[model samples]
Target: MGDFKVLRLVTQGELSWEVETRYQQCYQLTRKTCKKIKDRVTVFQAPGGFLFDIFEIAEVKHWPDTDVSEFTSITEYVDKTLSGYFFDQELKSALKEKADFFTFGVDVFDVNNDKCFSHVELVATYDTKLGKVSCWTGKSYPTEDQKRDFINCPSLETHCQRLNGIRVLVLGCHDLNMFSPRSRASIAPGTSKEIVINQMQKLCDQFKPQVVLQHPHATDSANIWNAGWAGVRKFLPEVKTYSSAIHYFNTFGGEPRQPLTTVLNRTATRDVQNIVFTCFEDGGIDLV
Candidate 1:
Protein backbone atom coordinates (compact mmCIF):
# COMPACT_ATOMS: atom_id res chain seq x y z
CA MET A 1 0.00 0.00 0.00
CA GLY A 2 3.00 2.28 0.18
CA ASP A 3 5.46 3.42 -2.50
CA PHE A 4 9.21 3.23 -1.80
CA LYS A 5 12.58 3.37 -3.57
CA VAL A 6 15.52 0.98 -3.26
CA LEU A 7 19.19 1.91 -3.77
CA ARG A 8 21.28 -1.12 -4.69
CA LEU A 9 25.09 -1.16 -4.66
CA VAL A 10 26.33 -3.75 -7.16
CA THR A 11 30.05 -4.34 -6.46
CA GLN A 12 32.29 -5.77 -9.17
CA GLY A 13 35.66 -7.28 -8.23
CA GLU A 14 37.59 -10.47 -7.57
CA LEU A 15 36.20 -11.55 -4.21
CA SER A 16 38.18 -13.48 -1.65
CA TRP A 17 37.02 -16.78 -0.21
CA GLU A 18 39.04 -16.32 2.96
CA VAL A 19 36.49 -16.10 5.82
CA GLU A 20 38.07 -12.90 7.10
CA THR A 21 37.18 -10.99 3.90
CA ARG A 22 33.54 -10.65 4.94
CA TYR A 23 34.58 -8.29 7.70
CA GLN A 24 36.40 -6.07 5.21
CA GLN A 25 33.35 -6.11 2.98
CA CYS A 26 31.40 -4.97 6.03
CA TYR A 27 33.78 -2.09 6.63
CA GLN A 28 33.61 -0.95 3.00
CA LEU A 29 29.85 -0.91 3.18
CA THR A 30 29.54 0.76 6.58
CA ARG A 31 32.39 3.27 6.50
CA LYS A 32 33.48 4.17 2.96
CA THR A 33 29.99 4.11 1.48
CA CYS A 34 28.53 6.05 4.42
CA LYS A 35 28.67 9.45 2.75
CA LYS A 36 27.26 8.28 -0.60
CA ILE A 37 24.43 6.50 1.19
CA LYS A 38 23.55 9.59 3.20
CA ASP A 39 23.91 12.02 0.32
CA ARG A 40 21.87 9.74 -1.94
CA VAL A 41 19.16 9.66 0.73
CA THR A 42 19.02 13.43 0.89
CA VAL A 43 18.87 13.70 -2.90
CA PHE A 44 15.85 11.43 -2.77
CA GLN A 45 14.32 13.21 0.17
CA ALA A 46 10.56 12.72 0.27
CA PRO A 47 7.99 15.16 -1.16
CA GLY A 48 9.97 16.02 -4.31
CA GLY A 49 12.16 12.90 -4.65
CA PHE A 50 11.70 9.18 -4.42
CA LEU A 51 11.70 8.37 -0.72
CA PHE A 52 14.35 5.67 -0.68
CA ASP A 53 13.01 2.64 1.13
CA ILE A 54 15.97 0.28 1.05
CA PHE A 55 19.71 0.46 0.44
CA GLU A 56 20.61 -2.93 -1.06
CA ILE A 57 24.03 -4.57 -1.50
CA ALA A 58 24.65 -7.38 -3.94
CA GLU A 59 24.05 -10.86 -2.53
CA VAL A 60 27.09 -11.97 -0.56
CA LYS A 61 28.54 -8.55 -1.38
CA HIS A 62 29.90 -7.93 2.08
CA TRP A 63 30.39 -11.63 2.53
CA PRO A 64 33.18 -13.81 1.23
CA ASP A 65 32.79 -16.00 -1.86
CA THR A 66 31.59 -15.56 -5.44
CA ASP A 67 28.45 -17.64 -5.40
CA VAL A 68 30.52 -20.34 -3.74
CA SER A 69 30.62 -21.47 -0.11
CA GLU A 70 34.02 -21.53 1.53
CA PHE A 71 32.63 -22.09 5.01
CA THR A 72 29.82 -23.98 6.73
CA SER A 73 26.43 -22.92 8.15
CA ILE A 74 25.49 -20.10 10.55
CA THR A 75 26.47 -22.07 13.65
CA GLU A 76 29.50 -24.01 12.39
CA TYR A 77 31.14 -21.05 10.64
CA VAL A 78 30.14 -17.87 12.48
CA ASP A 79 29.91 -19.35 15.97
CA LYS A 80 33.35 -20.92 16.07
CA THR A 81 35.46 -18.95 13.59
CA LEU A 82 34.54 -15.25 13.76
CA SER A 83 33.12 -15.29 17.29
CA GLY A 84 31.90 -11.93 18.69
CA TYR A 85 32.05 -10.00 15.42
CA PHE A 86 30.47 -12.65 13.20
CA PHE A 87 26.87 -11.45 13.66
CA ASP A 88 28.45 -8.35 12.07
CA GLN A 89 27.13 -5.97 14.72
CA GLU A 90 28.56 -3.15 12.59
CA LEU A 91 26.10 -3.87 9.78
CA LYS A 92 23.31 -3.44 12.30
CA SER A 93 24.72 -0.14 13.55
CA ALA A 94 24.77 1.04 9.91
CA LEU A 95 20.98 0.75 9.86
CA LYS A 96 21.19 3.70 12.25
CA GLU A 97 24.40 5.20 10.81
CA LYS A 98 24.47 5.07 7.02
CA ALA A 99 20.89 4.82 5.91
CA ASP A 100 17.46 4.01 7.28
CA PHE A 101 17.53 0.70 5.35
CA PHE A 102 20.35 -1.69 4.38
CA THR A 103 20.78 -5.34 3.38
CA PHE A 104 23.44 -7.80 2.13
CA GLY A 105 24.24 -11.53 2.09
CA VAL A 106 27.02 -13.89 3.19
CA ASP A 107 28.03 -17.29 1.86
CA VAL A 108 27.88 -20.10 4.40
CA PHE A 109 28.22 -23.88 4.38
CA ASP A 110 25.84 -26.57 5.66
CA VAL A 111 26.36 -30.26 6.22
CA ASN A 112 24.82 -32.23 3.38
CA ASN A 113 25.62 -35.30 5.41
CA ASP A 114 28.83 -36.16 7.33
CA LYS A 115 31.23 -35.83 4.42
CA CYS A 116 31.13 -32.52 2.54
CA PHE A 117 29.10 -29.31 3.02
CA SER A 118 26.37 -27.86 0.85
CA HIS A 119 26.34 -24.18 -0.02
CA VAL A 120 23.83 -22.03 1.86
CA GLU A 121 23.60 -18.31 1.01
CA LEU A 122 22.45 -16.02 3.84
CA VAL A 123 20.84 -12.57 3.45
CA ALA A 124 20.28 -9.96 6.18
CA THR A 125 17.86 -7.03 5.88
CA TYR A 126 17.48 -4.05 8.24
CA ASP A 127 14.80 -1.39 8.16
CA THR A 128 14.44 1.71 10.32
CA LYS A 129 10.77 1.08 11.02
CA LEU A 130 11.45 -2.58 11.81
CA GLY A 131 14.35 -1.64 14.12
CA LYS A 132 15.91 -5.13 14.00
CA VAL A 133 17.91 -7.35 11.69
CA SER A 134 16.03 -10.04 9.74
CA CYS A 135 17.99 -12.88 8.19
CA TRP A 136 16.89 -15.53 5.65
CA THR A 137 18.66 -18.40 3.90
CA GLY A 138 18.18 -19.49 0.32
CA LYS A 139 15.34 -21.98 0.10
CA SER A 140 16.21 -23.60 -3.20
CA TYR A 141 19.21 -24.79 -5.18
CA PRO A 142 18.35 -25.50 -8.80
CA THR A 143 19.19 -28.83 -10.41
CA GLU A 144 21.11 -26.82 -12.99
CA ASP A 145 23.44 -25.67 -10.27
CA GLN A 146 26.86 -27.03 -11.25
CA LYS A 147 27.87 -27.51 -7.65
CA ARG A 148 27.51 -31.09 -6.45
CA ASP A 149 26.77 -30.14 -2.89
CA PHE A 150 23.48 -28.29 -2.71
CA ILE A 151 20.69 -28.49 -0.12
CA ASN A 152 17.28 -27.58 -1.41
CA CYS A 153 15.31 -26.73 1.71
CA PRO A 154 12.06 -28.52 0.75
CA SER A 155 9.96 -26.92 3.49
CA LEU A 156 8.42 -24.19 1.31
CA GLU A 157 9.70 -21.59 3.76
CA THR A 158 10.50 -18.02 2.62
CA HIS A 159 11.16 -14.62 4.19
CA CYS A 160 8.29 -12.12 4.24
CA GLN A 161 8.43 -8.98 6.38
CA ARG A 162 6.74 -5.60 6.70
CA LEU A 163 8.77 -2.42 6.38
CA ASN A 164 7.59 1.16 6.20
CA GLY A 165 3.99 -0.08 5.95
CA ILE A 166 4.96 -2.19 2.95
CA ARG A 167 5.10 -5.98 3.00
CA VAL A 168 8.45 -7.15 1.56
CA LEU A 169 9.25 -10.65 0.34
CA VAL A 170 12.99 -11.50 0.09
CA LEU A 171 14.43 -14.21 -2.16
CA GLY A 172 18.05 -15.33 -2.22
CA CYS A 173 19.59 -16.62 -5.49
CA HIS A 174 17.72 -19.74 -6.64
CA ASP A 175 14.94 -19.19 -4.13
CA LEU A 176 13.56 -17.25 -7.06
CA ASN A 177 12.16 -20.58 -8.21
CA MET A 178 11.99 -22.53 -4.98
CA PHE A 179 8.81 -24.35 -5.91
CA SER A 180 9.64 -25.16 -9.51
CA PRO A 181 9.62 -28.89 -10.10
CA ARG A 182 13.14 -28.74 -11.51
CA SER A 183 14.31 -26.83 -8.50
CA ARG A 184 13.38 -29.88 -6.43
CA ALA A 185 14.71 -32.37 -8.95
CA SER A 186 17.96 -33.53 -7.37
CA ILE A 187 16.84 -33.16 -3.75
CA ALA A 188 13.51 -34.97 -3.66
CA PRO A 189 14.02 -37.61 -6.32
CA GLY A 190 11.29 -40.18 -5.80
CA THR A 191 8.59 -38.08 -4.22
CA SER A 192 4.98 -38.87 -3.52
CA LYS A 193 3.10 -37.08 -6.32
CA GLU A 194 5.85 -34.42 -6.43
CA ILE A 195 5.00 -32.17 -3.50
CA VAL A 196 4.60 -28.80 -5.19
CA ILE A 197 3.74 -26.08 -2.64
CA ASN A 198 3.23 -23.11 -4.99
CA GLN A 199 4.99 -21.15 -2.26
CA MET A 200 5.20 -17.86 -4.16
CA GLN A 201 1.67 -17.91 -5.51
CA LYS A 202 0.39 -18.80 -2.08
CA LEU A 203 2.34 -15.95 -0.50
CA CYS A 204 1.04 -13.53 -3.09
CA ASP A 205 -2.53 -14.73 -2.65
CA GLN A 206 -2.40 -14.84 1.12
CA PHE A 207 0.15 -12.36 2.50
CA LYS A 208 -0.05 -9.97 -0.49
CA PRO A 209 3.41 -8.51 -0.29
CA GLN A 210 3.94 -5.28 -2.21
CA VAL A 211 7.57 -5.92 -3.14
CA VAL A 212 9.71 -9.00 -3.78
CA LEU A 213 13.51 -8.93 -3.95
CA GLN A 214 16.01 -11.37 -5.50
CA HIS A 215 19.56 -11.19 -4.11
CA PRO A 216 22.11 -13.11 -6.19
CA HIS A 217 25.90 -13.16 -6.21
CA ALA A 218 26.38 -14.05 -9.86
CA THR A 219 29.79 -14.71 -11.36
CA ASP A 220 28.18 -15.91 -14.55
CA SER A 221 26.54 -14.08 -17.44
CA ALA A 222 23.53 -11.78 -17.02
CA ASN A 223 21.56 -14.22 -19.11
CA ILE A 224 22.07 -16.72 -16.32
CA TRP A 225 20.17 -14.71 -13.71
CA ASN A 226 17.88 -13.06 -16.24
CA ALA A 227 16.58 -16.49 -17.11
CA GLY A 228 15.64 -16.92 -13.47
CA TRP A 229 13.79 -13.61 -13.43
CA ALA A 230 11.96 -14.61 -16.60
CA GLY A 231 10.79 -17.64 -14.67
CA VAL A 232 10.20 -15.52 -11.56
CA ARG A 233 7.58 -13.21 -13.10
CA LYS A 234 4.84 -15.80 -13.30
CA PHE A 235 4.92 -16.55 -9.59
CA LEU A 236 5.10 -12.89 -8.59
CA PRO A 237 3.05 -11.02 -11.18
CA GLU A 238 1.04 -9.07 -8.66
CA VAL A 239 3.94 -7.16 -7.13
CA LYS A 240 7.14 -5.38 -8.11
CA THR A 241 10.15 -7.73 -8.26
CA TYR A 242 13.70 -6.40 -8.06
CA SER A 243 16.93 -8.39 -8.36
CA SER A 244 19.81 -6.72 -6.51
CA ALA A 245 22.86 -8.76 -7.41
CA ILE A 246 26.69 -8.74 -7.90
CA HIS A 247 28.86 -9.87 -10.82
CA TYR A 248 32.52 -10.16 -11.75
CA PHE A 249 34.14 -7.01 -13.09
CA ASN A 250 34.34 -8.41 -16.59
CA THR A 251 30.85 -9.88 -16.48
CA PHE A 252 29.12 -9.92 -19.88
CA GLY A 253 26.20 -8.06 -21.42
CA GLY A 254 24.86 -4.66 -20.32
CA GLU A 255 23.51 -5.14 -16.85
CA PRO A 256 24.13 -1.94 -14.79
CA ARG A 257 27.61 -2.17 -13.21
CA GLN A 258 28.64 1.46 -13.16
CA PRO A 259 27.35 3.65 -10.32
CA LEU A 260 23.99 4.97 -11.48
CA THR A 261 20.39 4.96 -10.27
CA THR A 262 17.27 3.75 -12.03
CA VAL A 263 13.58 3.55 -11.28
CA LEU A 264 12.04 0.23 -10.30
CA ASN A 265 10.16 -0.06 -13.57
CA ARG A 266 13.47 0.25 -15.50
CA THR A 267 11.71 2.81 -17.72
CA ALA A 268 13.23 5.91 -16.10
CA THR A 269 16.05 7.12 -13.90
CA ARG A 270 14.79 8.55 -10.63
CA ASP A 271 17.55 9.21 -8.09
CA VAL A 272 17.62 6.68 -5.27
CA GLN A 273 14.95 4.08 -5.95
CA ASN A 274 17.12 4.99 -8.67
CA ILE A 275 19.46 2.03 -8.15
CA VAL A 276 23.16 2.84 -8.23
CA PHE A 277 25.16 -0.28 -9.16
CA THR A 278 28.80 0.33 -8.14
CA CYS A 279 31.84 -1.86 -8.43
CA PHE A 280 35.09 -2.38 -6.44
CA GLU A 281 38.27 -3.80 -7.96
CA ASP A 282 40.12 -6.81 -6.45
CA GLY A 283 41.31 -5.62 -3.06
CA GLY A 284 39.58 -2.27 -3.43
CA ILE A 285 36.14 -3.78 -2.90
CA ASP A 286 35.16 -0.90 -0.66
CA LEU A 287 32.72 1.65 -2.19
CA VAL A 288 34.92 4.62 -1.36
Candidate 2:
Protein backbone atom coordinates (compact mmCIF):
# COMPACT_ATOMS: atom_id res chain seq x y z
CA MET A 1 0.00 0.00 0.00
CA GLY A 2 1.17 3.52 -0.81
CA ASP A 3 1.64 6.02 2.04
CA PHE A 4 -0.23 9.33 1.94
CA LYS A 5 1.40 12.61 3.00
CA VAL A 6 -0.69 15.71 3.66
CA LEU A 7 0.53 19.32 3.60
CA ARG A 8 -1.66 21.90 5.32
CA LEU A 9 -1.08 25.64 5.09
CA VAL A 10 -1.38 27.28 8.49
CA THR A 11 -1.50 30.90 9.62
CA GLN A 12 -1.20 32.56 13.03
CA GLY A 13 -3.65 34.55 15.21
CA GLU A 14 -7.45 34.56 15.13
CA LEU A 15 -8.82 33.02 11.99
CA SER A 16 -10.06 35.54 9.43
CA TRP A 17 -13.85 35.66 9.01
CA GLU A 18 -14.06 33.48 5.87
CA VAL A 19 -10.57 32.30 4.87
CA GLU A 20 -9.60 31.15 8.34
CA THR A 21 -12.93 29.40 8.85
CA ARG A 22 -12.50 27.59 5.54
CA TYR A 23 -9.00 26.44 6.41
CA GLN A 24 -10.12 25.28 9.82
CA GLN A 25 -12.96 23.37 8.27
CA CYS A 26 -10.59 21.76 5.82
CA TYR A 27 -8.21 20.84 8.59
CA GLN A 28 -11.03 19.31 10.60
CA LEU A 29 -12.11 17.19 7.67
CA THR A 30 -8.53 16.08 7.04
CA ARG A 31 -8.07 15.21 10.69
CA LYS A 32 -11.24 13.18 10.76
CA THR A 33 -10.25 11.37 7.57
CA CYS A 34 -6.84 10.50 8.97
CA LYS A 35 -8.44 9.16 12.14
CA LYS A 36 -10.47 6.75 10.04
CA ILE A 37 -7.52 5.82 7.81
CA LYS A 38 -4.98 5.44 10.66
CA ASP A 39 -1.54 3.98 9.87
CA ARG A 40 -1.24 4.87 6.19
CA VAL A 41 -1.49 8.65 6.82
CA THR A 42 1.32 11.08 7.56
CA VAL A 43 0.18 14.55 8.57
CA PHE A 44 2.38 17.65 8.32
CA GLN A 45 1.67 21.19 9.47
CA ALA A 46 3.45 24.41 8.54
CA PRO A 47 5.11 26.45 11.33
CA GLY A 48 2.36 28.95 12.05
CA GLY A 49 -0.25 26.22 12.56
CA PHE A 50 0.58 25.84 16.26
CA LEU A 51 -2.38 28.07 17.14
CA PHE A 52 -4.78 25.54 15.66
CA ASP A 53 -6.60 23.48 18.31
CA ILE A 54 -6.29 20.36 16.16
CA PHE A 55 -2.97 19.66 17.90
CA GLU A 56 -4.89 18.02 20.76
CA ILE A 57 -6.43 15.40 18.47
CA ALA A 58 -4.11 14.92 15.50
CA GLU A 59 -0.50 13.89 15.65
CA VAL A 60 1.04 16.48 13.36
CA LYS A 61 4.65 16.40 12.19
CA HIS A 62 6.25 19.80 11.84
CA TRP A 63 7.84 20.40 8.46
CA PRO A 64 11.53 20.89 9.05
CA ASP A 65 14.04 22.72 6.84
CA THR A 66 16.58 20.47 5.08
CA ASP A 67 20.21 20.80 3.96
CA VAL A 68 22.31 18.17 2.21
CA SER A 69 26.05 18.17 1.35
CA GLU A 70 26.98 14.83 -0.20
CA PHE A 71 25.88 13.61 -3.64
CA THR A 72 25.70 9.87 -2.96
CA SER A 73 23.67 10.41 0.19
CA ILE A 74 21.19 12.55 -1.67
CA THR A 75 20.76 9.93 -4.37
CA GLU A 76 20.13 7.20 -1.80
CA TYR A 77 17.61 9.31 0.06
CA VAL A 78 15.77 10.12 -3.15
CA ASP A 79 15.62 6.52 -4.19
CA LYS A 80 14.28 5.53 -0.80
CA THR A 81 11.65 8.27 -0.73
CA LEU A 82 10.58 7.34 -4.23
CA SER A 83 10.07 3.76 -3.13
CA GLY A 84 7.49 4.86 -0.57
CA TYR A 85 5.45 6.64 -3.23
CA PHE A 86 6.18 4.47 -6.25
CA PHE A 87 6.57 0.74 -6.51
CA ASP A 88 10.21 -0.06 -7.18
CA GLN A 89 9.69 -2.64 -9.89
CA GLU A 90 7.02 -0.60 -11.67
CA LEU A 91 9.02 2.65 -11.45
CA LYS A 92 12.15 1.03 -12.83
CA SER A 93 10.25 -0.55 -15.70
CA ALA A 94 8.55 2.75 -16.50
CA LEU A 95 11.80 4.68 -16.42
CA LYS A 96 13.53 2.18 -18.64
CA GLU A 97 10.73 2.24 -21.14
CA LYS A 98 10.06 5.97 -21.09
CA ALA A 99 13.16 7.89 -20.07
CA ASP A 100 16.19 8.79 -22.15
CA PHE A 101 19.16 9.24 -19.82
CA PHE A 102 22.54 10.61 -20.91
CA THR A 103 25.73 11.24 -19.01
CA PHE A 104 28.65 13.56 -19.81
CA GLY A 105 31.89 14.45 -18.05
CA VAL A 106 33.64 17.82 -18.37
CA ASP A 107 37.12 18.97 -17.34
CA VAL A 108 39.23 22.10 -17.85
CA PHE A 109 42.99 21.89 -17.61
CA ASP A 110 45.98 24.24 -17.50
CA VAL A 111 48.16 22.32 -19.94
CA ASN A 112 51.17 24.45 -19.06
CA ASN A 113 50.87 23.60 -15.35
CA ASP A 114 50.01 19.95 -16.01
CA LYS A 115 47.03 20.34 -13.69
CA CYS A 116 43.28 20.47 -14.02
CA PHE A 117 42.30 24.10 -13.40
CA SER A 118 38.54 23.49 -12.93
CA HIS A 119 35.97 20.91 -13.88
CA VAL A 120 32.43 19.61 -13.52
CA GLU A 121 32.97 15.86 -13.47
CA LEU A 122 29.42 14.68 -14.08
CA VAL A 123 26.36 15.84 -16.05
CA ALA A 124 23.35 13.62 -16.59
CA THR A 125 20.54 14.27 -19.04
CA TYR A 126 16.99 13.06 -18.55
CA ASP A 127 14.39 13.04 -21.29
CA THR A 128 11.51 10.62 -21.72
CA LYS A 129 11.14 11.12 -25.44
CA LEU A 130 14.46 11.44 -27.17
CA GLY A 131 16.20 8.21 -28.25
CA LYS A 132 19.69 9.26 -29.31
CA VAL A 133 22.61 10.13 -27.04
CA SER A 134 25.55 12.23 -28.24
CA CYS A 135 28.61 13.85 -26.69
CA TRP A 136 31.09 16.50 -27.89
CA THR A 137 34.34 17.44 -26.15
CA GLY A 138 36.62 20.44 -26.65
CA LYS A 139 39.22 22.55 -24.84
CA SER A 140 38.90 26.32 -24.41
CA TYR A 141 41.66 28.91 -23.99
CA PRO A 142 41.96 31.92 -21.70
CA THR A 143 43.59 34.22 -24.25
CA GLU A 144 42.86 35.49 -27.76
CA ASP A 145 46.05 33.84 -29.08
CA GLN A 146 44.99 30.49 -27.65
CA LYS A 147 41.46 30.98 -28.95
CA ARG A 148 42.85 31.68 -32.41
CA ASP A 149 44.71 28.41 -32.25
CA PHE A 150 41.43 26.70 -31.33
CA ILE A 151 39.71 28.28 -34.31
CA ASN A 152 42.42 26.88 -36.57
CA CYS A 153 41.92 23.36 -35.27
CA PRO A 154 40.22 21.16 -37.90
CA SER A 155 38.36 19.14 -35.25
CA LEU A 156 36.35 22.17 -34.06
CA GLU A 157 33.87 22.01 -36.94
CA THR A 158 33.33 18.31 -36.56
CA HIS A 159 32.68 18.62 -32.81
CA CYS A 160 30.18 21.41 -33.40
CA GLN A 161 28.25 19.26 -35.84
CA ARG A 162 27.95 16.53 -33.21
CA LEU A 163 26.74 19.08 -30.63
CA ASN A 164 24.25 20.83 -32.87
CA GLY A 165 20.60 20.70 -31.80
CA ILE A 166 21.45 19.38 -28.33
CA ARG A 167 18.65 20.55 -26.02
CA VAL A 168 20.85 20.84 -22.95
CA LEU A 169 24.41 21.98 -22.25
CA VAL A 170 26.27 21.23 -18.98
CA LEU A 171 29.28 23.39 -18.20
CA GLY A 172 32.20 22.51 -15.93
CA CYS A 173 34.32 24.81 -13.77
CA HIS A 174 36.65 27.21 -15.64
CA ASP A 175 34.18 27.10 -18.52
CA LEU A 176 32.94 30.53 -17.45
CA ASN A 177 36.22 31.88 -16.06
CA MET A 178 36.32 34.74 -18.55
CA PHE A 179 33.06 36.05 -17.13
CA SER A 180 34.84 36.74 -13.86
CA PRO A 181 36.53 40.12 -14.02
CA ARG A 182 39.21 38.98 -11.60
CA SER A 183 40.06 35.88 -13.61
CA ARG A 184 39.99 37.80 -16.88
CA ALA A 185 42.69 40.13 -15.49
CA SER A 186 45.10 37.22 -15.27
CA ILE A 187 44.58 36.18 -18.89
CA ALA A 188 45.93 37.95 -22.00
CA PRO A 189 45.74 41.77 -21.71
CA GLY A 190 42.81 42.16 -24.14
CA THR A 191 40.76 39.25 -22.82
CA SER A 192 37.43 40.83 -21.89
CA LYS A 193 33.85 39.68 -21.38
CA GLU A 194 33.36 40.53 -25.05
CA ILE A 195 35.95 37.94 -26.02
CA VAL A 196 34.20 35.37 -23.89
CA ILE A 197 30.88 36.43 -25.30
CA ASN A 198 32.14 35.97 -28.84
CA GLN A 199 33.45 32.53 -28.05
CA MET A 200 30.13 31.52 -26.47
CA GLN A 201 28.28 32.94 -29.45
CA LYS A 202 30.22 30.63 -31.74
CA LEU A 203 29.21 27.62 -29.66
CA CYS A 204 25.62 28.79 -29.47
CA ASP A 205 25.45 29.31 -33.19
CA GLN A 206 26.49 25.75 -33.73
CA PHE A 207 24.82 23.92 -30.86
CA LYS A 208 21.68 26.01 -30.10
CA PRO A 209 21.13 24.33 -26.74
CA GLN A 210 17.93 25.26 -24.89
CA VAL A 211 19.15 24.84 -21.30
CA VAL A 212 22.46 25.08 -19.41
CA LEU A 213 23.38 23.36 -16.13
CA GLN A 214 26.32 24.44 -13.98
CA HIS A 215 27.83 22.37 -11.20
CA PRO A 216 28.80 24.14 -7.95
CA HIS A 217 32.25 22.67 -7.45
CA ALA A 218 33.17 23.08 -11.12
CA THR A 219 34.38 26.69 -11.00
CA ASP A 220 37.12 28.64 -9.23
CA SER A 221 34.99 31.75 -8.54
CA ALA A 222 32.41 32.39 -5.81
CA ASN A 223 29.61 33.68 -8.05
CA ILE A 224 28.73 30.62 -10.11
CA TRP A 225 25.24 31.74 -11.11
CA ASN A 226 26.25 35.20 -12.32
CA ALA A 227 29.14 33.93 -14.44
CA GLY A 228 27.06 31.06 -15.83
CA TRP A 229 24.16 33.36 -16.75
CA ALA A 230 26.43 35.88 -18.44
CA GLY A 231 28.19 33.22 -20.50
CA VAL A 232 25.01 31.34 -21.55
CA ARG A 233 23.13 34.54 -22.43
CA LYS A 234 25.68 35.30 -25.14
CA PHE A 235 24.61 32.19 -27.00
CA LEU A 236 21.04 31.69 -25.81
CA PRO A 237 19.44 34.98 -24.85
CA GLU A 238 16.40 33.30 -23.28
CA VAL A 239 17.91 29.96 -22.39
CA LYS A 240 16.87 28.48 -19.05
CA THR A 241 19.70 28.04 -16.51
CA TYR A 242 20.21 26.13 -13.23
CA SER A 243 23.09 25.50 -10.82
CA SER A 244 24.01 22.70 -8.40
CA ALA A 245 25.39 25.01 -5.69
CA ILE A 246 24.03 24.60 -2.15
CA HIS A 247 24.31 28.32 -1.37
CA TYR A 248 20.86 29.36 -2.61
CA PHE A 249 18.49 29.24 0.36
CA ASN A 250 15.32 28.45 -1.53
CA THR A 251 16.78 25.79 -3.82
CA PHE A 252 19.50 24.01 -1.87
CA GLY A 253 19.73 25.19 1.74
CA GLY A 254 18.35 23.90 5.04
CA GLU A 255 19.15 21.11 7.59
CA PRO A 256 21.93 19.31 5.63
CA ARG A 257 20.12 16.00 6.18
CA GLN A 258 17.52 16.56 3.50
CA PRO A 259 18.13 14.57 0.35
CA LEU A 260 19.12 16.68 -2.68
CA THR A 261 17.62 14.15 -5.07
CA THR A 262 14.16 14.58 -3.50
CA VAL A 263 14.18 18.29 -4.35
CA LEU A 264 15.40 17.61 -7.88
CA ASN A 265 12.84 14.86 -8.49
CA ARG A 266 10.08 17.10 -7.17
CA THR A 267 11.13 19.88 -9.51
CA ALA A 268 11.28 17.51 -12.43
CA THR A 269 7.74 16.25 -11.76
CA ARG A 270 6.21 19.69 -11.25
CA ASP A 271 3.78 20.82 -13.93
CA VAL A 272 5.66 23.88 -15.05
CA GLN A 273 4.90 25.44 -18.44
CA ASN A 274 8.49 25.88 -19.58
CA ILE A 275 11.44 23.58 -20.09
CA VAL A 276 13.06 22.49 -16.80
CA PHE A 277 16.79 22.59 -16.10
CA THR A 278 18.03 20.66 -13.04
CA CYS A 279 21.54 21.16 -11.64
CA PHE A 280 23.48 19.84 -8.65
CA GLU A 281 26.43 20.76 -6.44
CA ASP A 282 28.06 17.38 -6.94
CA GLY A 283 25.73 15.01 -8.81
CA GLY A 284 22.00 14.54 -9.61
CA ILE A 285 19.58 12.47 -11.63
CA ASP A 286 16.61 13.89 -13.56
CA LEU A 287 13.44 12.44 -15.06
CA VAL A 288 12.47 14.91 -17.75
Give the best candidate by lDDT: 1
lDDT against the true structure, per candidate, is: 0.43, 0.30
Runs of candidate 2 exceeding 4 Å displacement: 1-98, 104-133, 136-166, 178-197, 216-222, 241-288
In terms of lDDT, the poorest run of 10 residues in model 2 is 54-63
Per-residue alpha-carbon lDDT of candidate 1 for residues 146-241, written as tens digits (9 for 90 to 100): 344443333334467665667666666566555343443544544421333344456566777656666666533454444445544555555663
| RMSD of candidate 2 to true structure, Å | 19.2
Give candidate 1 misplaced runs (Cα > 4 Å).
1-3, 38-83, 86-93, 110-115, 127-132, 146-148, 153-157, 178-197, 248-282, 286-288
Write one digit per residue (lDDT tens) for candidate 2, span 157-250. 2223212244444443234443444454455545443454456557667677554433333222234345445545553654543332221123
Among all windows of 10 consecutive residues in model 1, the one with the lowest summed lDDT is: 46-55
lDDT, residue 66, model 1: 26
Give candidate 1's error at residue 151 in angstroms: 3.2
Model 2: per-residue Cα lDDT at residue 228? 41
Q: List the residue pairs that clash in candidate 1.
A: 72-109, 73-109, 262-274, 262-275
